[model samples]
Structures are given as structure tokens and as C-alpha cells.
Target: MAPNRWLRPEVYPLFAATGVAVGICGLSLFRHITINPEVRVNKENRAAGILENFAEGEKYKEHFLRKFVRNKSPEIMPSVNGFFTDPSRN
Candidate 1:
């Protein structure tokens, strides 16, 4: 389309207004969808449940970890010495 022949000057502001209105509506929908407190609590509860079950399980906390500490003295992997540690050391 040629700029002076195909494009109408009056339609430019209409297009800009429509674009802005769509952007504002999208942002409003996104805010309502993301900042829901109930959904946040639900997500947090799921994460907390997983961590609690895995790290604080009675079998792991009381038995497996203790045996692992006794068997692997420093409990440090040669490749990841700084990254991993047995809770017994602390």
C-alpha cells in the first residue's frame, strides 16, 4: 500500500485507541488472574506439603540420614563438596 494513496490519515488515531484499549483490558485480566490470594495460598500449601513430606519424613529424618552420616564421614562429594552437606554436620 502506498503511504499517500492507500492509507487514510483519519484511521491512524482510531487504530491507536483500539490498541491502547486492548492493552488495558489485557492488563486488567492479567492482574486479576495472577494476584489471587486463594490461588497463592493453594500453591504455597502444595509446595510446603512436598518439602515437609520429603525432608521431614520420619523414616528419612530419623533413620536414613543418620545411617548415611555414619557411613560417609564428611559426606562431601568430591565434585560438589561445597554444595552438599549432611544435616548431622550442622
Candidate 2:
């Protein structure tokens, strides 16, 4: 009995290539659909000017701690006092 047309060796590579191409396109589409445009833009803007807006080392440290670290842990709140202290004397 003869093998089916799709089962032929020549057709197998074509099918494999098409399957790989479709998988790549599907993954690209999924990533675009899942990302939030506003968040992406905000991240880009922050990367561009994050340091320029907070030139002082202390201000930048305080802003980061307040935004990300303070709410993350109860134990950190007490030790965070050191972050606000005047660094010139230290």
C-alpha cells in the first residue's frame, strides 16, 4: 500500500516549517495582546528621565523606598529611618 500524500518526506518539511511560523506568529500576537500600553509607555518614560527628575541621591532613595519597599514589609518601616537621615554627616 502507498503512503498518504502528507506522509511523504518532501511534504513533512513544509508542514514543519508552516507549523513553526504559525507558532511564532501566535506567540507574538499573544504578547501584544497581554501587554498594557499605558504601563509600557510609563516604563519607557521613567527609563528616559527617572534620574533627571530625582537628581538628589536622598530624594531618589526616599521615593523608591516609599513607592516600592515600605508597603512590602512591616519590618522595613522601622529601619527606613536611616534612609531619610542626612547623609552629609555620615
Candidate 3:
């Protein structure tokens, strides 16, 4: 409960003084309370963000498919000769 909210002008200074004291003590104990002022997203870079996500997805897809193919039949998977002809895995 805020004392000033319920108390009058003469009583307000007392409350304010006490508040500053308590705040200083609390801040001393937990001094790491700082703002995380991160930059907001830019609307103009949306297309670039989309492209980055798409490219990342493409990378994962290729890696996954390649690994699957290599695992199914390493000898015929294409890591040696074909290196890119495993039909059933991808």
C-alpha cells in the first residue's frame, strides 16, 4: 500500500523519503535490473528475413535428404562415385 495514496501533503514527504530509502536498499541488493533495449524489427527487411529462413530450410532439407540417402545404402548411396544419385531417400 502506498502511503501517499492514502495520506495528505504533510504526510507525503515522509512516505517519499521512506520510499527512496527502501528503493536504494532494494537496488543495492538487486543491482542488475536494467532495461533490455533491443532494436525493433525493420519492416523493410522482411523480404530478407524470409529469404534467410527459406535458405536455412533449404539447407536443412538437403542435408536431411543426403544423410537419409547415405544411411539407406552407403555403398550405392553415391558418396563414392555417383555422389548424387540416391533416388528413394530424397
Q: How many residue pairs clash in each candidate?
A: 0, 0, 1
Score residue 79 of candidate 3 by CA lDDT.
65
Name the top lDDT candidate. Answer: 2
* Candidate 1 residue 35 C-alpha distance from true site, Å: 0.5
Better of 1 and 2 by TM-score: 2
Q: Is 1 or 3 the stronger prediction by TM-score?
A: 1
Which one is best on TM-score?
Answer: 2
Candidate 1 has its poorest 10 consecutive residues by lDDT at 52-61
Score each candidate by Cα lDDT: 0.59, 0.60, 0.56
Clashing residue pairs found in predicted model 1: none
TM-score ranking, high to low = 2, 1, 3
Give model 3's TM-score versus the native structure. 0.28
Per-residue lDDT value at 56 in model 2:
45
Task: Choose 2 or 3, whichever is better by lDDT.
Answer: 2
Instruction: Kindly list the per-residue Cα lDDT of model 2 for residues 1-90, writing each as its tens digit.
Output: 356855888898898999999999998677555552322345565476433333444443465447876656466465566567759547
User: TM-scores of the models, in the given order?
Assistant: 0.35, 0.37, 0.28
lDDT of 3: 0.56
Off by over 4 Å in 1: 1-6, 38-90
Give stretches of model 3 more than 4 Å off.
1-6, 32-90
